[model samples]
Target chain A: MTSMKTPVTLDLSAAKVVTDWTHTANLLCCRVDPTGKYVVAGAIDYTVQRWEIATGKKTVLVGHQNWVRTLGFSPDGKTLYSGAYDGRLLAWEIGLETPKPVKDIPAHQGWLRGLAVSSDGQRVATCGNDKLVKVWSAADGKLIRELPGHAHVPYCLHFVPGSHELVVGDTFGNIHHWKADDAKPSRSFEVKEIFYHIGDLAPFGGIINLAFSPDGRTLTASGLHKASNALAGSRRPVAVSFDWKTGEKRPKHESMKKEIDGTMWRAVIHPTGTLIGVFEKQVGFWNAGVPDVAHLAATPSDIYDCDLHPNQLDLYTAHYDGHLRAMRIGRG
Target chain B: MQEQHYRPCGDIEHLLGRRQFMGDLLAGAGLLAGSSLLASPVGAAEVAKRGKSVVVVYLNGGISQFESWDPKSSLETGGPFKALPTTVPGIHISELLPHTAKQMHRMALVRSLNTKQDDHGLANNLVRSGRMTQSATEYPELGAVVAKGLERADFPLPGHIATMPAGVGGRGNNAAYLGPRYASVTVGAEKGGVANAKLPDGMTVTADQRRHDWRRFANSRFRDKVDSVEIDAYTQTYEQALRLIERRELFDITREPTKVQDAYGKSELGKQFLLARRLVEQEVPFVEIQPGGWDFHHNNFEFHLHYVSDFDKPFALFLEELAQRGHLDRTLVVVMTEFGRTPRINTGYGRDHYSRAWSIALAGCGIKHGAVIGKTDAKGIDVTDRQVDHRHLFHTYLQAIGINSSSEFDIAGRKFPIADPAVGPIKELLA
Candidate 1:
């Protein structure tokens, strides 16, 4: 592993593969532990797996009864929380020698799409098909309060780092802001670019992923766009950013390189102010301040989720090909 | 007889004179061409007793059985949804169809379907026609067959009609050897009512009436001079067209009461179901509507959530509306797809096409309500008990409407056994 103790340049174009490990099933959602020593992912086969960063040893944590869609980690890195399509939320002690379930409960009425733990580790915000955003106790998995304002099913939620404030995105492309500490609804805005319908019918793939920039100034929503024929899976990957403080949408951000057919399933902000969007066929990284053309790298399989290791150099991706991939940024 | 079948406003009555008129028309046409329609029985006595009608809802691109009728959610192959109990005890379907689940008491499910053919075109033909493809012969689809077997020969409107998306509609050639008389006319799901159904704006009502009177007189004079089959068929078509023009408003669902339209909702499938109701009210024997885009080879679960949500409510409402209107006892409503999806989830989080095991739903008419027959194995890869194929369903459909499947179709002196004569109806499914 390269040391970041000395100053090093970050170059996405020259990113190199660091570690790649296999899972028995396709991984849907993934997260890097707070300690940055382990990466955890939830799989299609109903298991939460944690891999040791150095040994590459995989530990399967089974508890979820359905396809897990989102994962959150406690600030101490001792506990891992997974939200699944079956609406069940389970917390596991990932730090234990044999990590076991710490808490489990039915969190929503339907498929739970996103889960986010506050940086303080006191509050957890989640959203699902029930068209609700809920804040819960991270300790016992009890309901704190239901923050309801979304007109459509919400797919992703994220906490503005360092604070309990939250942002949630829905199928209609509406984003809601909530003061998580008080569990009250604030302002909301809809990005029509991520939502579309023909007549009374709408196809899937909305604002599926949400992430906050390190400085909490920019919030980016990621999903497929320009669905010419949603029925036939006619869609392209895209990312849309907004000024977090003013709630104003920025110019459309999309892959300007080789044309691709699927969606930008997940977007994460790099510590260096770069916005990284992972698509089904490619991963794109661009400086958020640059405003335009992104550096894209073709992936071997459909990438569903990705997380940046605390080391700020290793980016882990969960893929549909039943593999967990790691790549080092600025290899050149 | 018309009074027995609930018409509209609860004051409906069958026009016996129209029945006699249609019979006379059939006999007159038989004299011109010696057509098989007359030799073949026109209407079933039982169907005529209540004015039987059929509505078929085709789910384009097969839906996965695991996600609907025959869920194995406990098993690894069950995907991510839970199996929800319906109105009927011991009968549970996928939670994705919560709306349809409430209407389960009025419906029967056939879970163990082994249609075998996975190709869209072939499977569609096999299920709708109830016959395996034989190179030398093509059969009329269900709508056409139902139109031929159950029609009272009374409707000025086409007995067999398929409601489609606004532009992709016209005359369908699925009637096969049954001839154009039994073929279906295509209409819009939401927008255009019927193409060319209106009189020219320049022509007043009086002018159109005069033209109609002149055409009838000219047609009678021509018939007296030349008793040609082509002329008779043409005259029959022209007259029906005139009648259809008079009732053109029926095809426009926007004209339906606001409450009624709201009940059916605004989705294309919803409006089509509403249109099916309007046609059924006018005694159109066979009405079909296709809610397409079911082929979920990729993103199956995500799309199914969208597809099922769109389908669930309107269908349940259709059943409720039919029951309230006293049509449930006579209208045979069916929801079917070509096949079921694979139990194995693919790399794309989708279920591929699998014909070994699937499902279809039937309700109303002679179908046994709340009856669930057959079962698939735990993995949902194959039928484990009482497996029924499309042929059995065809026979059952005919039997439900009081048509004897063993009867032969006298298609211009060539004998064609109705419903593939080899397999019989699922007696358990018949009330």
Candidate 2:
């Protein structure tokens, strides 16, 4: 057998390219609203764009003063909350003329980096440069409590579906489990080996992006080598899976080779939760639990964000070069 | 009996000959060990009664000096929001906080906190920890120190507690370097059912009671096996947890009458403040309540109105209730943020982050109410006088509660000063 230089490779033929945003639309996130009618995307242009799934036409919700880092649609799809870098959390009523400021609790003293709304949409949790994970009431925008355990900045947060627990990832490559009630974390695990350390100067590197499979059985995280030489910009990407309940990390799947070169920005579980789309300089789709090669997609430039459509199996990818592309997947 | 003396080099003979001299040097270097050893009989007696408590309301995002406590009514930087007069003569606050203005007599407004860190994490750590930004060892939060210094040995509850807004963000709210035991007990209003302040459902009353008893028994057995200060600390933690369980009602704001709840506003922030009051009244030495989401890069006016409105009513009622209960004088309430929003409105019609000059307020306890400590330029850009930094801010809080900022704690066999060595409390604000 030929020597395998890479961990995984993807087949690009199955992906059918759809509409694309030429410029000013570096999409950061896409979510099919709870109603499954409109897909909303947080973009680098500091705007939240809504795409009609049927026609693929886009409408923009403009107001945020900085890059929109994360967005979540209310359970009814009528309300949307966008967390931005300018340290503001804004709320928008679907058809309203303008997005209204509901409860603007300066969530973090630094950039408002990441946000995750609970499955029920009643609680909204946010993590950022503050290095603290805060949980709030989505209905009235009141801060209910906070989790102050992480020593470094928390990059991502997700509420475990159907459980009163939250999984939080910090910049230090540690994943902590915080019970729904207690502000203190109950369990913690570190991925020391899988994570990269630039040197004594810059250590702490693990997964920056995390996504839980719909069934909550699996967790997919994208890893990157720590940037040792910032000027050299030599960052490589890798994907790892874990047993959500036991926190047992699986080996670096062999199927994902080409996708492991650049830094992975995001990993999104498809609607079915069986397929995950990983974004780096390009897009790669992999089947859950199979460890098979990821099917790579041809893209205009480096991919910064990707998300699955609310209902269909379509994928939306955003690029650093300011382009948003829509793609549909088909069976071989 | 000759007094026992110890030197940094661990030489007993040298320590005895120069005991007084070495003692002063060690104390100055923040290497003092054990409170009993430092105090002469007279000094020890004075230390016992002089320690006071503080309640810090850390507003995570920078609160604007112009809009909050130091309104520049005549300047172009003042923007559209107007200032309203308070109960104190010649004192005014933003129209947004009319309620707080009414209770101005119990508060002292510091209009010139000139902290260096404009960044949230650094500024918060600097102000809360009261150390220079690059200081090595993580300093204990003021609350943790109070917990260590003043918490009653028999008390079964955590000495320091923190209740913040769910999505409020920032750094320095943590109990750094003090270790896990002294970390603030975080209580949320939404998750973990803020109203149901108890063990989870699976843990029945009988089961919880058994767990508590068994934990105590196990700790006792372990203590007997290894007699050390660590065992005492662990036992104290266990007892605090037990006390928390017994006085769970203190954390339950829902148990209050509907009228009382309404007075504090039914909002999460209002309820959280109510919970904080309950905690301090129940004798938690320190409580930090963080209310964030104030960074208004665009539409700063509308954002502050919507957010601060929630704070206006409940905060006033909280102060009123505290004063009514005669706890205001013993409880120090501080309202501060990391920095402030920029005075200039940007393209997005928003104000970017500004750290040059900002406003912070303190009320109750040892603070002289109805006092305004400093002034900002007409445009609200710089501190005109009485400039304060993290050290001064922290020292003022410590002095309010009667803690000496010069107090030292030993870590890794080295003496670490609690507050910044350079700055002291703002004498003007102190009672």
Candidate 3:
């Protein structure tokens, strides 16, 4: 419902917007640092770009041979981990001038689907085509434990806070809860769908670009529409909320039919729990409590990634069309 | 047993003689004999001395426990199927497996196996490998270990043969960490049968013999000219390939009697299981027959009835044939799935994946016949006692085939434990 004009330079409206280095490479996945000082984006070129939240300067982290599929920031915000289709997880130190990989762990035999960092920063969990969710020592890149029980590829991984548990959703629509310390699962819940691919999990509400909610009380997951062929319509984005304690799930909120001509690339919860941002053709937002059609701003081309500034409720939207737009959230 | 009902023929004797001749040729060639084929020395002696083999009928998707092994006859969880009594007084199986129940004198049923994985991929990996997924290294499959421990190194065909699609049930069946050379030979749907594995098209015996002679001469010259380890490895693989070609008849099921073929069912899964029997009889240590499409999340009764009937006929026939041929005591037949379907039927009239408790059946070598181990609650919701996870299953499998499950493999300089450190074999299941 909103229309915006292209700008040569970054613009801040009634809402304070921050300037950031726009990326030329299409972004596949993005994560905000725990402290909100940096934003790490995995690009289609298999390189991870780390941007300083305050200055918008970028440092590229390179190692993956295939497109980086997912990214995670350690709890300490000192280390950045990226999962790629090349079946490797690369750990990058953010403090370095040019972000470089410190450890490269070949974690899966197939494409690395998801990556997550524990609350303590000591463990990192990853899952992929191997159907096993493995936890690694962030300190040494050594394998700590493996959580098994997924029949299909584990599409997303999330570490619930305050508990030693990790939640994994697979392509088969099954969600498993694995105890982080042990190599076994504590419980599992099945969503009765054919090919449900869980795209992302945001627990609690940090900005949409951040790791799971620091509290681990709530879980928000995005589902792909193409998982089941019996559905009459095309793939669309659906958001689900769950209580981390009781394992109770709320009715899913279905957004607008995913842009078939354009892919609904990424979805993140805004720092405020009420607002969730979905990036496809343009930047769109849906309120978690309200069951309404998501509204998107018109843009020149498909959007790849977007992030909210830590200090202000501003949005930084990046497009595959090689443009970055900084826009206000509240008003014109 | 009725004398005229079924009788052992002289075919087994002829096969034994052929096996003896091959063993003599192997010895003459100075190839390592029997258990010495194992890379590890820990169980080499015991494995070499033991002549046990395993035929695993892998039900790829989760098979419903209520419909198969732990049928709650009078309960709602029992679905529409009825449980029938077997020849063994107290033992019973689903009516679909009436043939198997008649032959229950040689089988042991584990009614309660509470494995953690309900997801197909994870459950398959865990159940097959008998270990949890570790981030540091890939775990070796139980079949791979069996092949490593018990198979002859110089044997022409691979010790482990899988006659199904890879990635059928998940990560469980792959020969992980065993390397590609030791990985199971996957025979396709049509060609996996014993008959189709013969010499290539348009090749006469005389021409084949001439080719073999030339290959031997060339190999001898190369061995004398180049003493490189890589060349030796290549030569060894080539020799193995030739040997497998020579024994191609072992894969042909048409060589079997018409009654035998009819007994195992005419379905793909049935034929595959028959092929597995032939492979083991030919001394291949481990053979995995994967039959998929058992997920049955909806239309539980109809789907299971169709699939289970297809499985039951062939499975029972395989067991009966093994017993009649006097190979049952030396061959282990295991029936397993990724996990069991849920006890409660959902709105779709299908059961979901349930990991809490399930069933697995073992017959033949080292297993206690007519024994039902473990138990589930009345509704089949949870394991009432004797919980067995993948670790236990792996341990039991190795123990049945005369290998120690506590063995470890060194991967990436770390001594990774092979099975779950917490669980061991169900001793009661072993004779």
Query: Candidate 3: which pairs clash?
Result: A32-A209, A151-B119, A151-B120, A151-B121, A203-A213, B125-B172, B194-B251, B194-B252, B195-B251, B195-B252
lDDT of 3 by residue, A196-292 (tens): 3111111111111222433556666554443332111224445566666787876754554544322234456654554444544555556656654
Worst 10 residues of 1 chain B by lDDT: B4-13
Give the best candidate by DockQ: 1
* Per-residue lDDT of candidate 3, residues B1-431 (tens digit): 22222223323333334434233222232222121121333345555535578888888778888888888743346554667898889776776677778878888999888777777788877888887765455666777777766766446677777776321111123555544334565553345343223444454566545555555666666677776544553456446645665776676677779887777766778778778778767777888887756776744664565577677777887887778888887888899788998877553346889989899888998888898988998878889888777788888888887777777655434465667668788999988
Worst 10 residues of 1 chain A by lDDT: A197-206
Output per-candidate TM-scores for chain A, rounded to 2 decimals: 0.93, 0.86, 0.78
TM-score of candidate 3 versus the correct structure, residues matched by position:
0.49
Off by over 4 Å in 2: A1-332, B1-52, B165-173, B176-178, B189-204, B212-235, B410-414
Residue B405's C-alpha lDDT in candidate 3? 70
lDDT of 1 by residue, A93-199 (tens): 89776787878878888899889899899988888888888889887678888887577887888887898788888887877777755545677877777777644
lDDT of 1 at B424: 95
Off by over 4 Å in 3: A1-332, B1-38, B73-76, B164-173, B188-235, B409-418
Better structure of 1 and 2 per lDDT? 1
